[model samples]
Target: MKRALTDLAVFGGPAAFLRPLLVGMPTVGDRARFLARLEWALDNEWLTNGGPLATELEGRIADITGVRYCVATCNATAALQLVLRASGVTGQVIMPSLTFAATPHSASWIGLEPVFCDVDPVTGCLDPARVAELITPATGAIVGVHLWGRAAPVTELEKLAAEHGVKLFFDAAHAFGCTSGDRPIGGFGNAEVFSFHATKTVMSFEGGAVTTDDGELAEQLVALRSFGIDRNKSVTAVGMNAKMSECSAAMGLTSLDAFGETRERNRENHALYRSELSGVPGIEVLPFDESERNNHQYVILLTDHAVTGLHRDRLQTLLQAEKVFPQLYFSPPCHLMPAYRTDPPLRLEHTERLSERVLALPTGPSVSFEDIRRVSSIIRLAAERGEQIDAMWAGAVPA
Candidate 1:
């Protein structure tokens, strides 16, 4: 009988393999739970917008997010578009260049010019003070990205937006379960859009939502998602078929119940990685406050610049060879993407550098603390060996 060489594979005795494609927690609901809701939808035959599960899910989400109203949509991008349109954003909208392109793309899709702004290197969030500097007479609104499940300083941005007399819309795709002070990450501004993509803290299989307190805007969003239906099919304004189907909503209903435990697991795994990877040479592991962050993705900054004879991309390849696949979540800053190529409002040096260095380990629900430990150890080993970890771009794919 042949003996196995190593205890790294999931089937090979180790609980974690080198590059286990974790079942990401950003899940909406369990199979049986969501399937049960699906059965409900099937029973009622209310299979479209405002169905039982959809309404129920939206209510639960609003309760979770501390918002007065929630509008579930086909996807996060549509939620963003609806909010931007409903808010009357025209001309320029200020946004961070370090985030996913969804923020700016939603603006552009709705005919608003996205004026790129800078981010805070420490927090990887749009700096409110820089937001002030980026505002112009043409600037219509501020789109704040709560990227990587870390809540931005929304309070500061709120003050800045009010002072500038512009609206603040949060692209809160990564902000499920994230909170600030007494409120969760919704309804703090004119609107905040959430993504229930399979990769988010919460998932509805594939859906998104807009949370707001304004009834008029909420009304508009409802009308807007259903092809702008007015009395007798008289279209009031431009809208799209951005409705979340019953299947998605049913899944969401199930997701809400079990998501708390998944969230707890994520936090726990993150703490382990944070403790294990700290002070490691040539790498910068995170140290975010648990009270504030949702710890959606356990990321590190590869100080590949500090490591001689090594680049970022080669490290990824080597990790892949070892079956330990860590993600370079944002390999090229959003501004560097082909669709957004233009003269910048300012250079995004820090943003670009971060894109080259940031590495996201397996922090999903399927990934155990043991998984993080192994991944962290491999990263440290790679850094010690000075393997070239080259940079790679994840282009234009919206978060």
Candidate 2:
């Protein structure tokens, strides 16, 4: 490999194009709106949760996601907590094992056990069948995350929830614009929450929201997010300040207007990656999110080590040398985290395998097709050179 023309902290190198993680990041116009809102707050005496800025952002998000009601929280984590608390959840909440750590943490926060279910290798969403099999006397709700950009199998899960008389919730953090059949994602479950962290698709710079068509449940969440203050002037229980600040909402309003362009650019970039990587020798790249790239986040399924002829860590390092930085999407499945140390993750065969092999590339609106091709070329090169790529990294100097 040639010398890195630019460090990842800057423009990145050929490796930059190859890697999933990058140092410098693209900007969000919505952020400017957030700054302006911050100015408005400063100009006035309002800050935190009381300003009009926060209200506007929530109202606008409710409009965009097509939900009848929306409530903004400090972050998606808080939003999930609010929902679970408001719903009065008790006992275990079923969810996929192959997701980010924060996902399962919510379960622990509310004193609910997180029952890890398996995933479908193709899409990486929770497997409803496995979820059904895991249902027990203590199970109260099912928390399904929209892994990658695709929506989880809502219809099946809903059926299972109904049969078992349990609630079903969807953690839609990765599904900013996700759809299921004819409707949007938030509409599918008993309740759904979205994340707007900077790295997410429709980031608020930092925020999360809960959307539901159920007017009663939506009202319950309202009280829970605002220190359990019943906005309706009736106190049902104790709640804390889980509200999104006015500034964050301002930024989100701006991103909402231009989110379409971002998703479109990413879709185009992904197509190029697919074209270049067809039929590679190591393993078949994942096709789940690929099918839904027209809408949500982008992700790749690495072929298992046995067939790919390469381990996930080795491929990651090889791509990093090319300046491409991919992440082991869920290096440690949530149930495996220290929070649940003794409560081991359930044996969802596919979810376990997926956590060990999936690697999501950078395909946000900012990434160009040129970037995609650059990354793909290095992968092809690795397949050609095989284990020889390891030699290149084994000899690198410590930085």
Using lDDT, give the best candidate's number. Answer: 1
Candidate 1 deviant stretches above 4 angstroms? 1-19, 22-29, 231-234, 293-304, 343-346, 387-399
Write one digit per residue (lDDT tens) for candidate 2, span 1-399: 433212222113343223355522443765566577678777876777646877777777777668898888879998888888888889999888788777878878878888777788777788777887889989989999887767889899999999999988999887867777767777777889898887776767788999888899988787877777776676668887888876677677777767788777666766677778888876555554334433435647475566555677777776666657787888777656666545443455676777787777767766777777777876776666555444444543223
- Among all candidates shown, the one with the greatest TM-score: 1
lDDT of each: 0.75, 0.73
Residue 56, candidate 1: C-alpha displacement in angstroms: 0.6
Residue 188 of model 1 has an lDDT of 79
- Estimate the overall C-alpha local distance difference test score of candidate 2: 0.73
Runs in model 2 lying further than 4 Å from the true structure: 1-27, 30-34, 232-236, 288-296, 341-346, 390-399
Q: What is candidate 1's lDDT per residue for 1-399, written digit by digit as tens? A: 322222223122443334554425466546887778788889999999678778888898888888789999999998999888877877899898887777788889878888877788777888888888888899899988886777888999999999989999898887887887767888778999998887766778899999988888898898898889854677888888999999988777776677787778777777787788777777776666656746355455455646534467755755555566677757677777888877653468667777787777667677767667766776676666553222112222222
